[model samples]
Target chain A: MKVGILGAGQLGRMLAIAGYPLEMSFSFYDTSGSPSVGFGDILVDKGGSGAKLEEFLNKVDVVTYEFEHLPLELTQKIEKLKPLYPSSKSIEVCQNRAKEKALFTELGIPTAEYRVATSAEELAEAAAELGCPVVAKSVTEGYDGKGQAVLRDVADAEQAWSSINHDAVIVESFINFSRELSIIAARSTTGEVAFYPLAENNHHDGILRYSIAPAPKVSTELQQQAESHIKALINDLDHVGILTLELFETPEGLIANEMAPRVHNSGHWSIEGAASSQFENHLRAIAGLPLGNTAANKPTCMINIIAEKGDKEAILKLPYAHLHLYGKEERTGRKLGHVTVQADSYEELVWRVKNVATFLPGSPEFISSIS
Target chain B: MKVGILGAGQLGRMLAIAGYPLEMSFSFYDTSGSPSVGFGDILVDKGGSGAKLEEFLNKVDVVTYEFEHLPLELTQKIEKLKPLYPSSKSIEVCQNRAKEKALFTELGIPTAEYRVATSAEELAEAAAELGCPVVAKSVTEGYDGKGQAVLRDVADAEQAWSSINHDAVIVESFINFSRELSIIAARSTTGEVAFYPLAENNHHDGILRYSIAPAPKVSTELQQQAESHIKALINDLDHVGILTLELFETPEGLIANEMAPRVHNSGHWSIEGAASSQFENHLRAIAGLPLGNTAANKPTCMINIIAEKGDKEAILKLPYAHLHLYGKEERTGRKLGHVTVQADSYEELVWRVKNVATFLPGSPEFISSIS
Candidate 1:
């Protein structure tokens, strides 16, 4: 079988790797043009001459993607010939903050109360209703904490207007929280559900720094609340692939900050920690197959190595951590690799993972103390 | 870091997968062309031509292998340039039955009594001394139960001479073994040892059919004995990388049946079932890094899913059993994929593994009864 991938990034390369074993072939349509090109025999298609792109895509059996930011029209066009997972409509709703907030309100799902702002005057009113210290975000194409800012006062709110640099933005009340957590799950066409354990996350510069599965200190009631909210979203969306919902654990209760409609970085531990990984499960769901178990094996904590390795080979010796690299060419601050460390207990897993990078000589001081 | 891999087959593909995260490039020099070309950029070298082979070998900083049938001359040549794991002596011993028996004798490692037969007259005398129900095997190039025959009487033993094709054969008493088991371990140059739990194996038509980790009924004493013997072999050979000891469980204790100088199939479960997988550990050993813990996370049973899947996609949906495919184009009885299932206990694990294949409706009739 042939599958057409919408992007030629690392995720696409990994998809090609998974497809190879199933006797499936892939053609990658990349925007970057230099994605792990030599790693797999992935035919590159860059909308090369309108006719050529169509011709290459025509030869495949299905279409999928690595991440969002795909043109909705391009995806819709591809959907006319074959299925596009998570559907272009699903992508449309989740891609922009404004659209996502509207959908959540329409579905009666609780979200940070918000409104759209077209100018500075609009920000004051939205913030007035939403409350001070609200978040102002570009309605579209923002990720990793970019294109967004917090409004603490009238002057702080003024900066939100110039920063959006677009026709529209959304202002949301910032929830006071104890910690941040996320739920990574997959839903099939048949509504079959597979959910990984809640992973507690800590971030730096808005990029995920560490994630540990089966988040400790989480009450059973909180976990159940998180799952029900996630199931409601997947069902409401009629989602057909993996979904990641990042949430805040507030004193009031669990409240979702946002959601991603694909395999997420925060779920990396599943590759070695779970009975079956989110990657394999995503493939299974996409292939119209049943999902594998999402149970954790040993207590596992995943540490992002960042683009910080001056000599990446230093990690070749880490005792209990499993390393995963994206096969991308080097550049400073690029997400080069990750290490998943597993242990007999959650504390030990956390302890070992936090100290792992120090083992690599000439390694930077990126790791933060967990204790 | 540089990783030199021997025999570029599917195992090399897997090693490449394990190596990518370290940013450590691999050079897989195959006597037959680059076998893992589909998954990684494999630089092929022509073995029949001497200069081309040496040029290819010059590219890698170290060497490891996917299969053990290495050309002694080529290996020796490569050894002059860089280290060859398992040592040339271990390869020489494993390559021939006569030499292997002699090494076992010298090492004081126990084995079934046997005699070398190079002629039909000698074959008769060997069978008489060992017993009528003796097994005859060609001394070299024997694997997956190939080039071996079980005899019942004098007439049956006479045919063994021709079956051996007059090549050197060993005549030995058939072992009354309770089960087949294997011990996989990695020893670094620093003398640190890491051992995977013993795994019980079941074979069909001479190929490994399945493996059960933490061998269900092995006593603590027997487990320790198996580990000690493996450690001694590693120290004796001063072995590097991974060493897999295939053994037979007898009434006395575990007896060494064969040894693989690299990762073994029985240890594949470590990918998800242990703190670190054998593949990851092998790379660690050769990279001159520390070894990871090998403790099993739960009772695990990995059942090989042969190529005859009625519908490969449909059957791959099992919740707990992680599946790995060799990327080989399928054929009758070919090794297409394997399913790994885990549970809290051995009995439950075996039972759960049996039903794991129910996800594949196209599987054979017996699959339902013996997943």
Candidate 2:
């Protein structure tokens, strides 16, 4: 099967890697022009022209995107010519914070209290009404902590709104949480759904630094709760392929932070830690194949290789560390690659992760649920 | 690093898949005009000219081969320009039966009584001397039970010799073996060695049909014995990358059959059953990276998809089964792909393998050391 992928970045490269063994060919449509993935037939549709879209559609049997923040008009147009997994509705909802929060509320999935603000006065009123230290994010086009600001006081709303640089912003009250977690689930064309073990994620500067799989001390009830909530959203959206729901574990309960309608960073550990990786499952789901086993085989920790290249020799020397480097030049805040450390126990996993971090110059201190 | 592979068959395709994650780029030099691997930079050197050879060398940092059956002169030329893993010496010994047997004898490994014959009369004499029921095989370029004939009596030697079609043939007394097994080990440039657990193989019509890993009922003493024999050959050859030794398990002990200097079909189980796959280990060894753990994580069975495609949906429905297709059109007696089934126990593994076999037409009956 020939698959057309939107956004030719590391995720698409990894997806193509996983898809090759299944005898699936890939053609990547990169709007960024400078695609990170070198192999496969790539169409650089920088202008998103109809002719290029037609050519890409003619080359593939189905369409899927690695990045959810795609132009909805382009995705919708592609959907008319070929099958698109997760549909344009997923992109539409995920791109707008208000739409996403409304869907979460309709599905009974808990999220932070917030109000949409079109003016500075409304932003201040929402902040004052909800409490202090609220997060104000653009209603559209925001990710990786971009186009966002933290208002510690209601008096700072004017500055936050102006800096956000959007017509409207969603002001959300900050929820006190113990840790961040993410649940990745896949729904196939035949309506088969499978969920991977929850991953406990650590972030610095709003970028994911570490993700530990089968998050330690997760109760059966909590896992079921997370699964049920995600299942509700998946079925409601009629979503196909991988859907990742990010959560904040609070003393009150689990609160939905955000969700990505694609293969996510937190689920990268599945490449080695689980029986079937998220990349494989996503491809399988999109191709209408049966979902594979999502069970974790061992405790695993994935550390992002950001900005700079690590000592390849030193990292490869660690028997438990699997190094994955994207063929890209180093740039500040850019994700070059990641190393996944697997061990029989969480204790050994933590030790190995720390050892691997030494080779990565600016890596954050290794931490996990157990650690 | 850029690695050049001699053959662009499924093995080379899989090697490329394994190497890509290590941030390695591949340029395949396929002597056959029809290269099966679709991805990567492929150069079809069908005429074997100096210009094409130089072009291939200029594209890669190091050279290796997936298939050993190549023109020794060409390999020797490439070796002078680039570092070739396992070297030409290993290839020279592996290409001929007499040299391979001599290496085994010199290393004090046990083998069946055999004699070389240059004529049909000599072949009959050797069969008579070996007391009939002997197997006659070409002295060079024979694999997968090809270029071989089984003689029930000395009178059948003339037909057998003619059928082999080689200038010289080796006639050996057929030993009564309990099962066929293979040991896969990798040696790095720094002389670090790691061995995967032995895999019990089953063949039909000279083609391998199934391989069960961590062969059931194997004693630690037996495993160590297998390991030590392969280790001796690896060190003796001063070989780097994967070295696979096929053996016949008789009541007396393990008798050496033959050796391949590159990754073998028997080690395909390592892709999922072992902590590190043979393909990954081979690349790591050739790249001068540290060897990974070779321990088996579960009892696994690899069933070869030969000559025909299977019911993919049916096979995929078996949660334990992982399908790998080579993107090749099905033809008679051709290896199309393989399915790997992993289970926590041998009992469950056998059951799942049988279930998987139902989908693959013409697959041999499921058999293993345990079942």
Candidate 3:
């Protein structure tokens, strides 16, 4: 079988690697050639050129996208040519923050109070109703903590609206969650589902810095609650691929944050730590194959190799540290790759994660907080 | 760094997969267009065509071969153009049974008694010295039980010689070993060495059928003995890549039967069962990178998906079974792919191996012996 992917990034590359063994080939549509150019000998339509897009779509049995921000019109066209996983409806909900937050509230999945605003006056009204300290975010074209601003007082509403560069926004109650957690879940066309252990994630400047799998010291009830909410989302969307749901663990309880309808960065440790990797499971889910085992083989900590290429030799010399360089050019604040360290004990995992982080440039100091 | 490889079969394909994560690209020289044609877009000199040989060599930093049978002249030419791992001398020794056995005996390694014969008349004499039921095999161009014959009586010499197409034969005492075992060992340019757990192998009609990792129930002393011999061979050759030693576990001890100077079929289970796969280690050794951990993570069995393209869906459904298809056209007796099953115990590994084997065509009945 052939799978058509909308983007040719590391996620698509990893997907291709996982899917190849299962007798599946990939054709990617992207402007820049996927650095994984040599992974398979298939045509890549530059910039999703209309002529090449039609040709690419005709060759694939199924279609999917690595990045969720692909234009809805393009995906709808792909759906007409072939089946697109995660469904256009799911993408529509995920693309618009208002729609995503609205759905969560409608489903009774706990989320921070929020309201849509199309003007500075309406933003001011939303801030007044939600009280001080609100976050105003552009409803579209936002990621990596961009296109959003914090308004500490009602007087800051005008500046927040201008900072986000638009009135098409979702203004929301600020969440003072103690921790951030995410669950990597997969659902097959047959409705069979599986999930990796919850991961506690840490972000630096809106980019994921580190993710510890099985969320050390997390309560089992909290883990079950995360899985339940994730189950409801996948079922509601009738999704047939991997989905990642980020959540906030606040004093009140777990609150729905946002979700990515694709294989996630938080689950990359599964490549070496889990019985079957999230990449493999995602490929299986979309290819109509049975979902694989999602249990972790050991406690694993994945530290992102952001912006700067690390001292590979030093990182590799660290025992049990598996390095994955994305074969991408390094730019400040860009995710180049990651390193995963697996150990028998949580203490060892933490130590190795820190040791690995030390080899990479611009690694967050939070890694040294093992104490 | 780029690594040049001769013969783009599944072994080279796997080597590319392992090296890509480490930021290495590959350029292969093969007439068959390398079954892994998509691994990289670098030039592939078809049949090592003289016109393109230098062109191909100039594009690579170092050279390695997936198989040992490349003509000595071609490899000598490649050595002059680029550094080839498992040097030309090592390849010369491994390409011919006479040289290989001589080296083994010279190194004081235990091996089957043998005599190099150039004619049928000399073969009869070798039988007299080695005793009846001798095996006559071609000194070169032999693999997978091919180009060999057995003589049960002195009178059968002519038939045996004719069976192997006459001359250039090595007649040896037919080994009646209890079991077969193999060890995958790696050596870097700096002499850093590591060995994966010994694998207990089973062969059907001289083709490897299945390999059980850590060679269930093996004595630690026996494992050490095998490693010692392998260490001697690599150090003596000053080899800088992975080499595999296949031995017969006889009642007296172990006897060196044959060796491949590259990744071996028996080590495929390391992909999932070990802390680092043999393919990855081979890439690390060749790239001048630090070697990875070789410890087996779990008990595992690898079954060759030989001669038949099995029901992929059924095979994939087997829990914890990792599938690897070589993307080859299947013919009777061809190795198309393999599946490795990891489990908590030997019994469970054996059971899963059989369950997976049932989905493939022409699988052996010996898989059920675990019961």
- The docking category that best describes candidate 1 is acceptable
Candidate ranking (DockQ, best to worst): 2, 3, 1
Per-residue lDDT tens digits for candidate 1, residues B305-327, read 66655455444555666666666
Which clashing pairs does model 3 show?
A31-A47
**Per-residue error (Å), model 2, residue B223:** 2.1
**TM-score for each model:** 0.88, 0.96, 0.96
Candidate 2 stretches greater than 4 Å from native: A46-51, A366-370, B47-51, B364-370
lDDT of 3 at A170: 91
Per model, state how many residue pairs clash.
Answer: 11, 0, 1
Q: Kindly report the docking quality category of candidate 2.
A: medium
Best of the two (1, 3) by DockQ: 3
Question: What is the per-residue lDDT of model 3 for residues B1-371, given as tens digits with 9 covering 90 to 100?
Answer: 88888877788877877777787878877766545534554455666566667777888999998989888998898888788997998899888999999999999999999999998889999999999888989999899999998888888988888888945899899888988999989888778999998999988888888899989878889999999999999998888889999999999899999889999999999988887789888888877788888989889888898888788888767667888987777788888889889889888787787788778776757565544
How many clashes would you count in candidate 2?
0
- Evaluate model 3: give its lDDT: 0.85
Q: What is the Å distance of residue A212 in model 3 from its true position?
A: 1.2
